[model samples]
Target: MIRLARGATGFRGPHEAPLPRTEAALFRAACFTAAMEARGRAGEMVPGEVQTFRRAALSDGYGRVFTALGHVHLPVVAFTTDPVREGEPVPGFADPPVWAQVFETAGLRVMGVKELMTPLEEVDVSELSPAELTEIRYWKPSCLGDVLFNWWD
Candidate 1:
């Protein structure tokens, strides 16, 4: 499992408030991306795609913590937080050891833990095409997950 927290970077949404730094918030975002990929819609997520992702994420017991908090919405822009500086304590919001134990108990190997920072620019306003933007948003988190998991291999 990858643990993420808010740092110098921040996130914004098209029609909602800024992303919170709470564990539930991070879990929800991760689960949303996971759900999108699971449904093979990792390229573009339309407004209607939300319910499907919600249902899929909720089906996984680990995601219940987020679902129980109420409705979950897709963020238009999500910047990963900056990596924790070496020798610095991990943020309280992202307790890596705790998360590692949780995944271990679930029989999942923790390839690594990552702290995601939001990009400095507005991804939504980039010159990239809409499809490209969507694809980036959909795959960013999973890409990080893959990289972290394989870093030692």
Candidate 2:
């Protein structure tokens, strides 16, 4: 089910849903890091900033939270693939445009792209045929830092 936090605004499609708490926590950490990096405070994050980010995250909800730092909107998309078992290697894409086309075919709009610093096990595209990857059930938020961060934040 798609659950919206109080006062949040964004597109909530039939397939979209609120992020789990663990995912939300990780996204919060990533937002804090991105916001700090933009401020030249890379290694020093204060409680006040955390508080602000937490507020924004809660207010913005899970699907597309906008940070206080500005110009950065969370990118929410998931690939259609089975969950990666432990010790399994993550899949790689040689052509991003084609990879994106897979998502487009599944009814998801490709907002922006960002490289994952850490691999996410929940989003495993290894076993999916190109056709299977275009199914709606395969798309959802699989990891933190999956969204893009701009210089403003």
- Candidate 1's clash total is 7
> Per-residue alpha-carbon lDDT of model 2 for 21-94, expressed as tens digits?
22334333544544343332222221222111121221112232222211112323222122222222223211
Global fold similarity of model 2 (TM-score): 0.20
Give lDDT per model, in order.
0.27, 0.27
Q: Model 1: C-alpha RMSD to truth?
A: 15.6
lDDT of 1 by residue, 1-153 (tens): 332322112233355444433233443444454444334221122221222111111222233221111112222121112332223222212223222233233332323223322232322234333443454355453333221111110
Off by over 4 Å in 2: 1-22, 40-110, 113-153
Clashing pairs in 1: 79-117, 79-118, 80-116, 80-117, 80-118, 81-116, 81-117
In model 1, what lDDT does residue 42 have? 19
Which 10 consecutive positions of candidate 1 have the poorest summed lDDT? 48-57
